[model samples]
Target: MKINEYNVVAIEYSLKDANTNEQLDTNVGGKPLEFITGMGQIIKGLEAEILKMTVGDKADVMVAPADGYGEYNDQAVQVLPKEQFAGIDLVQGMTLYGTSEEGDTVQVTVTNFDDNEVTIDYNHPMAGKTLMFTVSILDAREATDQEMATGVVGGVASGGCCGGGSCGSSGGHSHGHSHGEGECCGGENHKHGGQGHGGCGCH
Candidate 1:
């Protein structure tokens, strides 16, 4: 089936930083990632790639910073008073969540610390890096009524991917779940199965 709006698709992917050629994410030994298309569930570049695919098709895609996470912004870094982290053990190289000006939840990394200053970087880890994606379309089909209602494709009837008696991974890991019979996160479909390279890091 051709991947289109509301169609379910399943794909295996390997993601890397184009410039550094560093592996960023992959589907090896992991569940296939699912989502709804044209619904803003996946990254724009990936969505665009899916639109050009057919069932059983495979392609290697290179996404620029603009199409991926955009260039890093130095202004995103903020230095806060160390006292703000009082009561929590502070450590370097730790990741923390913070609110952006637009009130969106953002991930920040602790870069440095002094007697009173805590330096945090708000840029996304992938920001400024070009992305390389190798993807194979495994399955693509129409969404079932149940799947559409629940807004997901692969799990129990509760419509949630995790957080219930539904199928879940060990160690708090989870793949996308379906709410309806044919409903998936996007118009893709498939389960992940393969060997882990280093460890199951979900990437």
Candidate 2:
């Protein structure tokens, strides 16, 4: 079937940072990545490119930050009192996984910390970068009833970004389907879909 809206697509892909040439994530020899097309289960740029492809097709697509994970939000960075993180040792470049005020599974980095205050950045770790994807479409098929209703193929789940034991994650690299407000954790089904805020990067 053509890979249109509501179709389930399976693909093998490798994601990399365009500038650094560092491989961010890949699902090549493992299980092929799968998601419902037009459901926001993947990033906008990648999905748009996939929309133009068919089964067994191969392509290399470059995604801008705005259409990929998304541009970094300066306002999302906040400087607050350190008391908010009592008992935890504060350090620069530390990623913390915890629940937000809305009780969502989230990861934030410790940008700076002082005796009186701390700076937290809620932007996606890969927020502002051009993403390069080498992808091959394996198959495309109709979505099942359950997948259509929940908007995900797998059951809802969560993980941490760095080392958030509170999130019950061994390491913080894995993520789930809910990224607070915006962004879908697309790769390997580890993160959330960016339905509200536009799709962002996934692990």
Candidate 3:
């Protein structure tokens, strides 16, 4: 059946920067990325197009910045006192995690720094970039009430690649689904389908 709201969907996908054709992330030969449909578990653009596909289908989907991580905001860039980042060796372009004002985990990149001040970009690393997703649908089915309620596939927790808060990374890159800010899907402690927040860079 075509994917619909709360349907558990699994797919193997490879993401690339549309402009530069730089491969960002992929799960082609690994665990399939699974998420609930119409629940904001994944990027808006990707979900919209995935709705048009069915199991066993493959296609390329392009997502604009607005539908992906959102446009890069100048206001998201801030210069804070270097003292705030004490105890860590700061490197340019390195991503750092911190709690936001709302107590959510926020990922920021070290853009520049000096002895007194540090410049960080709160915008997601993929912000303002169009993404290309080569996707192959592996499975799609209606979610049970429990699964829908918990946003967990099969309504049971397991330690899959990107499951249960472990973002299964390669070279420090995560290929899990991304939503609000840096929220990641399939986190066991937090409800999935946009209810919880975690760390993952793939969008």
TM-score of each: 0.69, 0.71, 0.76
Q: Write model 3 residue lDDT over 49-75, tens digit each, in one string.
A: 889988889999998977777777776
User: Using alpha carbons, what is the TM-score of model 3?
Assistant: 0.76
Judging by TM-score against the true structure, name the best candidate. 3
**Residue range 21-130, candidate 2, lDDT tens digits:** 98877767876666777777677788899899988899999999877656777766767777776766666776666545444455566788889987877666677878
User: Which of the two candidates, 2 or 3, achieves a greater TM-score against the reference?
Assistant: 3
Q: Number of backbone collisions per candidate, in order?
A: 26, 11, 0
| lDDT tens per residue, model 1, 1-203 | 78998776777788777788877667656666565556544556777988999988989888786665556777766677777766545567565543333433334556788989888765555667778888888888786776666656643533312111112212222223223422222122211111111111111
Give me the overall lDDT of model 2.
Answer: 0.62
Against the correct fold, how does model 2 do in TM-score?
0.71
Model 1, C-alpha of 7: deviation from truth (Å): 2.9
Higher-scoring candidate on lDDT, 1 or 3: 3
Candidate 2, which segments miss by more than 4 Å at Cα? 87-91, 97-106, 154-183, 186-203
Poorest 10 consecutive residues by lDDT, candidate 3: 186-195
Query: For candidate 2, which ten residues in a row score worst on lDDT?
Result: 194-203
